[model samples]
Target chain A: MKTRIPVAVAFLSGFLMIVAFFGSGEWLSMLTNEALRYMTIVAGFSLLLGVVSITQVSWGVVRKRGEDWPYKIILLIALAAMTGFGVLQGITGGTVFEWLFDKIQKPMMATMFSVLAFYIASAAYRAFRARTVEASILLVTAIIVMIGRVPMGQYIYEDLPSVANWIMMFPNVAVQRGIIIGAALGAASMSLRIILGIERTYMGRG
Target chain B: MANQGNKGFFTRLQNVDRRVLFVLIFASVIVPLFFPLKLPVPVTPETREFFEAVEAIPDSSIVMLPFDFWPSTLAETEPMAVVGLRHLFRKNCYVVGLSNVGMGGPSIADRLLDSIGGEFGKTYGIDYVNLGYKANYQAVMLGMGERIEDIFPTDHRGTPLSEIPLMRRVPNYDSVSFIFVVSDNVAVDYWVGLVNSRFGVPMGAGVTAVMAPKSLSFVQANQLVGLMGGMKGCAEYENLLGYPARATRGMDSQSIIHLLIVLFIVMGNVGYFAAKRKAKVEG
Candidate 1:
């Protein structure tokens, strides 16, 4: 009953919203808004669940004597700091609480992305070998573009830029559009299953 | 093994070493940027078709623009958003912007909206209103179709939606001419499913290059009104909007990266086939 209840609600709510689009009823909007709030509450609870699960794992790591366990402690500490700061901010709308979000959170995300620069470069070195005709063309094109973007490619060859330009404008655009359209159709099918209550994986098991 | 039998040039070319292809692609991409390859990019009927949708809508027609990409995708999306927004503003359209990605999305949108909207004397709530990131994309989409304000109870500025003149008159998606989904993730799919399929709203999206091929399928099915894909899409958009901005620059960067990938692929394949030929002859 508990599992079926959520599924039923998802199905009915999906139908109501679909109906709302065609009709001039004011009631559907209110019902949809209520559903949005309900979903938000459920999403919020996931944060608590995540925190509790992390704490339990860290406690286990502390209990067990293992090398590199200090990292687990660090993870738990950071998690606690973020959770505490967030809760305090919510309780008392103050500037200091906002500071953690601005200073710590924002920088962490930027730094994480910057770290990818090294990873991508490493991936390029290992994977960018010219082992075939296609690889050679790719390596050459990549070199041209890489060089062209910087001061080097034009310094070496005059026509590399124009050649690079044609590839991106025509071939790349055609390929990308094809892929996105295919993926969207798949998404439509999946969402339809959810609406029809055929996809019940999202519903919690008894 | 190299794919044998009756194969066309393009199909045979597809089997080349990925790296070699990457290099060619890279050179093909980067050279244009440093050298400023001002090659003419023909604005396709699709882009013009999409531009018209937003352009034809009368000025002050409320539009919902969702930014569903982050900084990584900023390389692809920001330009599309900027170009589309500029065109909208040129038409004197009022935008109701929101983000479904995360806090970062709204943050980027906030800065961009401020800069772009400022150019047009666009006042918040008066010209545009930004609602910060909201979870439950499906529910938000549902709420938007019925009543946009109810779903976004508070504007980014913490003002109630009822107080906002735009929200009061135009309560839902039915009022908006179109929805622009600038996405690097699966967020666009959610929009298509919830809004386009359910409500028949005209939907357009900008996505990354890697995901562009999949997007074509949507275009084929007419599920999408139009699309701007990756750096190239940005480049075309730059040409469309007459900015020649980041997308143009990144197109160069992207072309270089693609060339590098292609070069490596070609090398791998050539080496493999050569080795195979040698073994067969030796035996």
Candidate 2:
């Protein structure tokens, strides 16, 4: 019955969504919105399941006094602090929570992102070469683009801008076109699998 | 005859070290950047088309800006976002901001919008409302298409979207001049397939250069109105705004870095051929 209900919901919801596009009625729109609302509710349940699994793993590792036990304790402390503040703010609409969100959370997000700057250089420094034909082409193109992109580079050398422009407008466009075609083919295959019910993996294993 | 050896091309290919390649690629990117090179740009007909479309909208259009890119691509995307919102505000466009991803987005978006929109005397909630994070990506897109209030019952605060003066009478996409996506990993195709086709509204994308190549098809198919690519696109838009912003500054670093990479590539190829000739002579 549970399986039947889902399969039925899937078939009906999927069909109606397509209809909602064509039908343009308030009832159909509301139905579409309700499906989204219900999906969010289900996602909440899924999240709860995830939180439980994560807590259990952390607790288990801490019990064993694993090498990373201190980090696990830190995680628990942060988890409690965030959850407490989140619930409290939701209940009271307080600014203390907003303060914590702005001061602490935003900085943390920025710091994580800033780490990528270092990593991009480190990765690029190791990869760009001209040992092979393809590698040579990429190296040349990358150079042209890097030079072409910078104002100072153009100032130092007059022709750099023209070269950069050529690389991006011509070769860059060609490569981008290839990616678009490849991605289109992929999106089609995945959508087809879902429509045919062959991609039941999205629903999880029985 | 030297090429006839059993340990030929494939042998050399198999033993290449990625680290050395990294250094060459590094040099290839950086040298040109320091050298100062500015290429002539002929704005593509499609990008021009998008700019005209935005211009065609009424003086005080209600526009939806979706902050979909995370902090990962923030460096590349933020310029377009800041500039686009600036232009929107300049035109007296009512802003409705939403994030299809994380909770962190609204605060950053809200603060940036307030600072920029403040210049044009735009107020929060009335002129611009940050709808905050909506869970379930595809579903949210569909929900917002019909009734945004249903998807977001309240503004980021406890206030309802429908209760807001600007949102009170607006009916779906008709009221939304366009949905502008300043995104990195979220491709233009997703916008076209998920949002544009779903809602039948105009969509625009500001994408990173690496991702720009893949996005041309949406432009080709007329699914997207405007396609802004990377820091250069940001610089061009900055020029359009009559202001030099982060993208303009970043262009210095970007240009130099690209040159450094190219030089390294040439050096590596030169070194490789020289090494091959030396080995042949020794043999």
Candidate 3:
């Protein structure tokens, strides 16, 4: 009864959304619009779910004195402090929140992102060996794209940028379109299966 | 010590400490910044198209600039956002700034608009307004097509959208002449699908370098009227704007890093081949 009722609701909602998209009925528009608003509100609450999950995980780590437990404690503290300040004074809460974000979060994000350069360089050096004919082709293509994408490539060879643009415009676009189309078809099929009650994975039985 | 003959130079090269590689990459990126290469930034057609598209917007036409990236991508996309905002403000276009990514985005937009708007002698709530962050990108986007105020009742600072002077003139996609989403992720696709295709609003993208290749099809199909790809794209736009900024300064470092990575790959392959030959000889 539980599964059946949820499936029926999903089907009805999905069917109405389709109608709202295709049909011109004013009620259909209102129904879909309200549904969208509901979905947004639901999504907003899901963020709270994320916060709760993080808190639970962090608390468990600290309570157990797990590896790097101090970091976990710090994480919980920062999270609570940020949320408290944000709720009390809002994002524009001036000095404290702004200072925390700019001084701590912003720099941390930047540092993490910056470390990618070193890692990418290391990974490339270790992995980009031309072991096979296919790998050789890939290596050459990658080098060409790298050169072509930057200004130095133009300095080195006037036609390099054009060649790079051609590669991106033709071969890259062809592949990207294929992936997009495949994903869209897959998503459509999955949506159809869900609406028809053939896909009950979301109900935790699959 | 006896097996040292088998440990050829190539094998040794293959075992180079990773720390050394890191240092090389770091130096390659950092040193070039101090010593500017001043290489010519050959503008791509896509970037040129982006600039021309923004330039062609008739004066006082509204533009929707959606900030859709966090600080993780601030390095790549922020410059584009800065230059894009500058271009719009320079054109005297009425701009509406919003963020769908969360608090980070709206704050970034607020700062960008405040810094850039002042130079253009633009006033908040009049020439430009920041609608701030809203949840559910699709819902917000679709709702905006129907009525923007329905989705964003207030600006980031809690000011009523109705009270904003610019909001009176621009209510939805119909009023906006151009929409550019500066994103680190697939939010550009949402803008393309929801806003542009459905509402017929012309759209552009300022995306991270990693995302540039994926967006080529949209540009080719004219679904995205223009694309500014990463920091390079920003440098091109800055050149067009005649205000060389961070993106321009960083290009030298970017160029050197690319070359360093390429050189690393080539060197690794050389070592690989040498190791293979050494193994055959030993056998």
Candidate 4:
């Protein structure tokens, strides 16, 4: 009965949305918009679920004195402090919340992101070998694009940037469009299956 | 076995410690900054298209702008957003900012607006309004096509849209001249698919370098009118705007880093081929 009720609800809602797209009826459109709003609200509420999960995990780690309990405690403290500041002073209230975000949050995020450049450089060196025909072609194209996209590329040769643009505009676009079309078809099929109740995996049972 | 000694050098190079490479990359990015290369910046067609799109918008026309990126991508995507904002304000276009990505988005937008809007002496709720971060961008985009006020009853500042002079006049996509989405992800796709394709509102994107290649397809398919890809793209836009700024300044470091990566690839290949030749000789 539990599974049946959810399936029924899903089917009805999904079909209504599909109908709403094709149908011009005012109520159907209104119903679709309302459903979308509800979905948005539900999405907003899901952040609370995330907060709960994080709190549970962090609290458990602290309680157990796990491997990184110190860090867990810090995380909880930071989370609590930031949330308290945000709620108390509004996000744009610009004292504690802004300071935490700018001084602590942003710098940490930037530091983590900056690490990617070093790793990508190292990875490119280790992995970009041209032992085979396909690999050699890829390596050469990559080198060209890398150079052509930068200021130094124009210094190397006048036509380097033009060649790079040609590659990106033609071959790259073709491949990407193919992938997009394939994914769209797959998504459409999946959506149809879900609407028809043929796909029950999302219901937590096959 | 005569060539064994030469093979050791190549093998060692192939197995060089990554820390050494990291140092080299770190130096490559930093050393170039102290000594600026001052290389001539070339404008790409994509960036030119983006500039022209902004330039083509008639004065007083409202542009729908979405800040759809995280702080992590601020380095690459934020510059484009800032420059784009500056150009829009300079052109006397009414700006409406919103975000569906997260709450941080609206704050980021506010910071940029406050910084740039002050320079132009633009007043809030009159010349521009930030609807703030909504929950579902797709729903917001689609709903706004029908009626924007129904979706966002108030601006980010809690002022009613009706009270806002700009919002009262520009209610929906009918009044919005362009939809500009700046994101690290495919949030531009939502703008393109839901708003552009469905409602026929023209759109463009400023995306991070990692996501730039994928966006080329949208530009090619005429789905997006223009695109700004990463720091280089931003630099190009700055060049076109005749207001060279951070994006231009950062290109020297970016150029050096690209050259270093190419150097690493070349060195790795040289070592690889040397080791292969030695193995072939032994066999």
Candidate 5:
């Protein structure tokens, strides 16, 4: 019954949206709009479920005193504090929520992202070797693109930027289009399968 | 003895301490910041097209700016957002800010809008409105085509859309003249596929460097009117505006780092080939 009901709902919704896309009736448009609204609302409520699931998992680890239990405790405390502040004072500027986000959260996130530059440097030094013809080609291309992206490349060679642009525009776009078309075809097939009740994996185990 | 020492040096180069690389990168980034190389930044075709797209918008036309990026990518994306908003306001466009990212996107947009809008003496609600973050971006985007208020009933601050003067005139995608999405994620895809393709609204995007290659296809296909790839792209836009800001200042550091990385790669390759030849001779 669960599988059947979900499949039926999915089919109806998908069919209606497709019909509305090609049709021009006001009622059809209204139906599509309502469906979209309901989908958004349902997606919003999923966040509540996520919070519940995480709290349960973290609390279980804390109660059992498992590995990294201390981290779990910290996570729970942070979650509670942020939620409480958000619910009470809101996340507007100058509030406790905003303060935490600005002072602690923002810098931490930026620092974490900034660390990628070091890692990229280290990775390139260790792994970017030329063992074969193809590897040599890739290595040369990478070096060119890296230099060509910066102003120093122009100082070194004026035509470097044009070559880099040509590579990005022609070869890059051609490959990307191929991948996009392939992926779109796959997505269409999957959507068809779900609509036709052939894909019941989303319903979970029986 | 000298030959053996040479072999050791080459072998060590193949596995140089990562900390050394890290420190070199750190110095490269920091030194440029203080010294200010002020390298000449040439605008790319894509960035020029992006600028033209904004310039083509009629004065005081309503435009949607979606901040679908997080704070982690603020270094690259924020400059794009700042330059984009400044240009739009300079042209007297009414800005409607929104986000597909529920986590930090709305807050970031709110902060940027407040700071930049204040600079231009633009009034909130009257000249601009932040519709804020909505869940299920795909659905929110599609629903917005029918009625924006249906997707976002209130601004990020919980004020009803009906109360906002700008929102009164901008009801749906039909009313919006253009959409400029600054995202660090694949939300740009949904913006192109669902919003632009269906609603026929012109769109542009600013994405992180990692995502730029994929986004270039959209620009080539004319799905996106323009695109800004990364910090470099942002710097180019700043240059075009004749208002060199944070991005332009950071380009020197970016250039230094790129050069350092290339040097490291070349050194590593040289070491590998040397080691290979040495082993062959010994064997």
Candidate 6:
């Protein structure tokens, strides 16, 4: 009975959305918009659920003095402080929430992302070997692109940038289109399966 | 003795410590920043198309700018957002800003709009309005197709859209002349697939360099009127605008890093081939 009810709800909603896509009527459009609104509301509630889940998990760790419990405590404190400030003073500029975000979070995130450059450079040097004809072709292409996309590339050769553009425009687009088409078809089929109740994994274990 | 020394050198090159490479990369990035190269940045066709698209928009036309990136990608995406807003305002276009990204996307857009809007002496609510972040971007996007106010009843600061003069004129996707999506993720796909394809609104995108290759197909299909791919793309846009900012300044560092990586790759390959030849000789 539990499974049947949820499955029925899914099928009804999915079918309505499909019909709304094809049909042309004010009532149908209104119904679809209302459904989308409800979906967004439900998604918003999920954020609250996430907060609750994290708090519970972190509290449990702190209570038990688990490994890295201190970090968990810090996380909880940070979370609570930010949430409190956001609720009390709002998240706009000149607020504590915005101040913390700008001063602490933004630079940390940027720094973490910047670290990837070093790893990418090291990986390229170690892994990019011309052991075979395919590898050689890839290596040559990489060199051309590396030279062509920047100002230095133009200095090295005026036409290097043009060659890089051709590679990106032609070979890259051809492969990307093929991938996009295949992925779209797969997604459509999967959606149909879910709507038809053939995909029950989302319903959780029996 | 010469052959022995050659073998040692090749082996060392093949097994250079990763820490050494890290230091080199760090130095490459930092040194260029301290000593600016002011290299000549060539504008790409994609960036030119993007610039021309905004330029072609009639004066006072309404445009939607979606900030769909997080702080992690601010380096690549922020310049795009800044220059895009600058260009839009330069044309005297009414701007409606929003975000599909949940984490800090709204805040980023709000800050950019405030700073850039201040530059143009533009008034809030009259010249621009931030619709802010919403959850379930798929639903938020499709709902906006019918009525934006339906999805976002209020501005980012919780003021009702009814009070915003800009919002009063913009009702739905039909009212938006163009959408310039600044993203570092797959949200661009949703904008292209769900919004542009469905509503027929012409769109352009500024995506991270890593995502550029994948986004090229959309540009090819005319799904995106123009595209800005990473720092280089941003630099190109800045150059076209005759405003060389962070992106232009950072290009020198980027160029040095790229050359350094290429040099390392070449050295590694030379070492590999040398080792192979030595093995053959010994055998």
Q: Point to the candidate with the largest lDDT.
A: 6
- Identify the runs in model 6 with alpha carbons over 4 angstroms from their true place: B1-7
- In candidate 1, stretches whose alpha carbon ends up further than 4 angstroms from where it belongs are A1-33, A55-206, B1-45
lDDT of 4 by residue, B15-124 (tens): 66789888888897778778888887898888899889889999878998899988877888789888988999999998999877674677788888888888899998
> DockQ winner among the candidates?
5
- How do the residues A65-137 of candidate 6 rate in per-residue lDDT, one tens digit apiece? 9989999999999999999999999987789999999999889999999888888888998999999999999
Q: Sorted on TM-score, highest at the top, how do the candidates line up? A: 5, 6, 3, 4, 2, 1
Ten contiguous residues minimizing lDDT sum, candidate 6 chain A: A197-206
DockQ in order: 0.18, 0.35, 0.72, 0.68, 0.83, 0.81
The better-scoring model by TM-score among 4 and 5 is: 5
lDDT of 6: 0.91
Per-model TM-score on C-alpha atoms: 0.71, 0.82, 0.96, 0.95, 0.98, 0.97
Stretches off by above 4 angstroms in model 3 are A93-95, B1-6
Give the CAPRI rating of model 3.
medium
What TM-score quantifies how close candidate 6 is to the native fold?
A: 0.97
Clashing pairs in 4: none
Candidate 2 CAPRI level:
acceptable
What's the TM for model 5? Answer: 0.98
Poorest 10 consecutive residues by lDDT, candidate 3 chain B? B1-10
Q: How well does candidate 3 match the true structure in TM-score terms?
A: 0.96
User: For model 2, how does the per-residue alpha-carbon lDDT over B22-131 read when each residue is reduced to its tens digit?
Assistant: 56545644664566444433344444566667667787888888877665566777888898888788788888887765655665676677788887788886788787
Chain B TM-score, structure 3: 0.96
**lDDT for each of the candidates?**
0.67, 0.69, 0.86, 0.85, 0.90, 0.91
Off by over 4 Å in 4: B1-7
Q: Per-prediction TM-score, chain A only?
A: 0.75, 0.80, 0.94, 0.93, 0.95, 0.94
